[model samples]
Target: MTDVSTSDETQVDVETASESESSSYDAAQRRSRQIEADLAGDAGRYRMLTGDRPTGRLHIGHYFGSLANRVRLQELGVDSWIVIADYQVITDRDGVGPIRERVLSLLVDYLAVGLDPARSTIFTHSAVPALNQLMLPFLSLVTDSELRRNPTVKSELAASQRPMSGLMLTYPVHQAADILFCKANVVPVGKDQLPHLEQTRVVARRFDETYGRGSLKAPVFPQPDALLSEAPNILGTDGTKMSKSRGNTIEIGMTADATAKIIKRAVTDSDRNITYDPQGRPEVANLLLLAALCTGRTPQSWADEIGDGGAGRLKAVVTEAVNSTFAPIRERRAELEADPGHLLRVLAEGNARANAVAEATLDEVREAMGMAYDLA
Candidate 1:
């Protein structure tokens, strides 16, 4: 009877082990399916590389443009890379000192805005040397005329009074290098950036066609797709593009009083009635939009709620809303400011992880382009 009991116990142990293994496998499969569902919502595929040129502090426009989407993407378990384009800033501006400060400030802003460092990797463009090196061979894949014909380049040049530098001209190529180096399959971009992604795909195609030895091996380059963002265009207080240089943005980290003052000074029409007519009443409409965004209420609903209020009353309501919305962010920013070293460590750790990926990609790129071991 004792021998029989031992045999039964061993059988039970083996069955329990098998069940545990099965449970783990099922959990992994469910996790993968959840990721697939998230990607399917945005068309298909995973992994995203999106960023901002750290020219100044983040504002409402940045939040509406890509930062909000980033928050959602992080929750969805997507592998996200938020690049602080420190090097790319030189294409538009001439100084590095301000850019360095902006990068650190941007890091603080990102953290305060809920970009949990545990979920997302935030790193500087210049710190990733391997990504920069990929630009050399990538430059060879496209012609000068193609670069000049890029609509983004044309528009930026027309907008800027500064002389176009070589860096500015090849800005698209550097962006291509950033995307391709990570083998990122998706890039969340605005409509204005489609041309740059197109150039990136072109480079990927060129690289593959030039050196894809088909033998069941991984391709030299994986063509990335632009995941165009569907967020609304956030207008500045002046009813134009929100820009720091234009003095139109309301800084996300500003005090409530400062934010209220900015809203009070916002441009508006002489219309007495509070209506949401964007075309005819751009300024008034902008105020309504701001209020709606702040209160988490629809513009149409807010317009009806504040009926009969003139533009002055509408501005006051909008100011209150703006102040309330950013209050938590400002508070968080103050807390982070008290411990600047902690923020630096987060950035440093992120940079090290980013560089690991960048270095591996650069090795593959150099080997494919026959640039490896020349110095050896």
Candidate 2:
């Protein structure tokens, strides 16, 4: 690395990078505002695409971070498509678990969290052939350097226990296929996922410019925009980003007793005074935030209520708040879990719907590239 203290050229390059980042942030903010306004007026006109990798059961972080937002969008009457990214499980991990089981479990979580199957088209990656088929044309639209430079890919690679697979390297392209397959115009995502969405946008633009010209349709895919989630990043019991891998998450499937136990063990500062200082007292604040989220109150207000009652009182309040909030959902989840046949049927229906949409999109893609030889 060049020393910025001694090298003027490196300093200039650093400044340019900062300016570019700032410009991108500004552009995203503008686009986000416009998308928000459009959704408010005619939400049904927008099709949203979002999903999880089916790595494991979702926790509170997944709930507030994205799942709840998904429920909100579905309730708004937006055409929602949820892809259970079962195939992407192997992107970084070497050994595979029972994906079908995980997919079913994931579905239960989605349904329990109010993601109605009727409103959102929920399907798995491996089940949708036409969706995966778009990978071939999209692969050519991007270069190796572009794929390598993607921040999400880089972070996944750095964190992976095994060597990076070809699928992992071209992960963003596959994601582009996910978005474009349904021509999804609105993708709900967090800040970290903007780069992946940007790559999807690039693919859509390049494909239209390259193929959707000269006797073909003007554009075959919508340039999807990111619908940024306003949810604050919920930290795990350990004060880090909540994750399944971290073993710190309080999963929705977990019993109330289990949740209380976990909260009791959460890390906090030595100071007994209960306060909402995220930077200074992140652990305590995280607990307060969890309680606040569950109870529909502000973290500071919760802290004020606790009023130096210390971590023990805070944990008790959080436990009750969480258990009370999720009691109904857990009951519903049990009902769903009892009927494996019904779960399978839900997957079947979702898969059928996704296949039909994907087939139509793929047909458009073929026609645009002049690959539809069957056409007279």
Candidate 3:
């Protein structure tokens, strides 16, 4: 019954695989360190451009994922451009009508979250039509296969179980335009969004290699580097990715009782005792994460405190933390929403500022491609 073999070949193979993984991990660490050094050295010199789709009100996942980084960068005096991707809403939902209110809501959220218009240029994608003109040249740099291979697009299509529209397929190119138009040198993204940023880099590089190589030593468009957020992603109540489409998301400015109700209803394991087992108890861990992020404490510490009472106590803490932190934000959002005209004026001024940058960049692109016959 004792038939066990430990051959040299198997041992060598195992060692080889382990060494390979170790080498890759080392390389990644080195890269991360380099980026940290570079940002620390001259962070204000960097121009950041990041934003959200105005499909719905921003949620907890949106806040923790990248929004917090945006605030930090703005405070550090990095020239930032916050875009509202209005066109993107129709890429998936063509039937959605009257997005103006949603756009206003998103703007209010941005303001409520301390995204100062004085420091950041907040504008809608539709306002900067010149940015779209850059997309044609950018699209020529990318291929149909590459677009289809984009993980973000592939995942969305898979989830929808529908053939992707051309607009949906070329959304990455549109993203490239968004980055390049503003001459954004940095973009804050998550692990999943790295591919999209890479595609933008490729397009920028290809354009430079093809056109800018002759006149300009480097590309006219800077290949934007990612400023990956250190904050952990927040999950939905049901242990899935928080999403607006699924109605599983807790909008940041929801009433305190509503927030508590949603947290109370969040799924957790049958175990009466609480422990920080992410794999075994994802839902409970998520609640703990929410509390920890809101309170600046450790998830395990929260789990340890809620040892006997189970998920209910954890939910209560998370609810209180979130509401307490977001109380001022909600009040600001309400104040802004009450005076919609004042919000529009702010957006209008931002649009003018964005258009100035976008048009200047477009003029450069047209000149680079020898399409600007009117250039004097």
Winning candidate number (TM-score): 2
lDDT by residue for model 1 (1-376), tens: 9999999999999999779756744554454455446674653246778888887888887876778788877777777888899898888677766776788889888888789888788988888898898888889889988998798788878999978999989999999987887788877765557678879989988887775554214577787766656667668888888889899988888888888788888888776778888888877787788788778888888788778888778888987887787788889999988898988899898899889999988777767756678666
Ranking by TM-score: 2, 3, 1
Displacement of residue 375 (Cα, Å) in model 2 is 5.9
Score residue 129 of candidate 2 by CA lDDT: 98
Name the regions of candidate 3 deviating beyond 4 angstroms: 1-32, 156-162, 216-218
Q: For each of the candidates, give the backbone clash count.
A: 0, 0, 0
lDDT of 3 by residue, 1-376 (tens): 2233457667888999779756744554455456667776677788889888887788988888777778878887788899999988788776556689889988998888889998999999998889988888888988889998898788878888677788899999999998999889888775567778889989999988888876655578888877665768688988898998778888978998899888888888888798887888788888888889889999999888888986677777888999998898899988988998989998998999999999999888777787878836
Q: Give the alpha-carbon lDDT of every model.
A: 0.80, 0.90, 0.84
Alpha-carbon shift of residue 268 in model 3 (angstroms): 2.0
* Models sorted by lDDT, best on top: 2, 3, 1
For residue 17, give model 2's deviation from the true position in Å.
2.4
**Model 2 bad stretches (over 4 Å):** 1-6, 159-162
- In model 3, state the lDDT of residue 171: 95
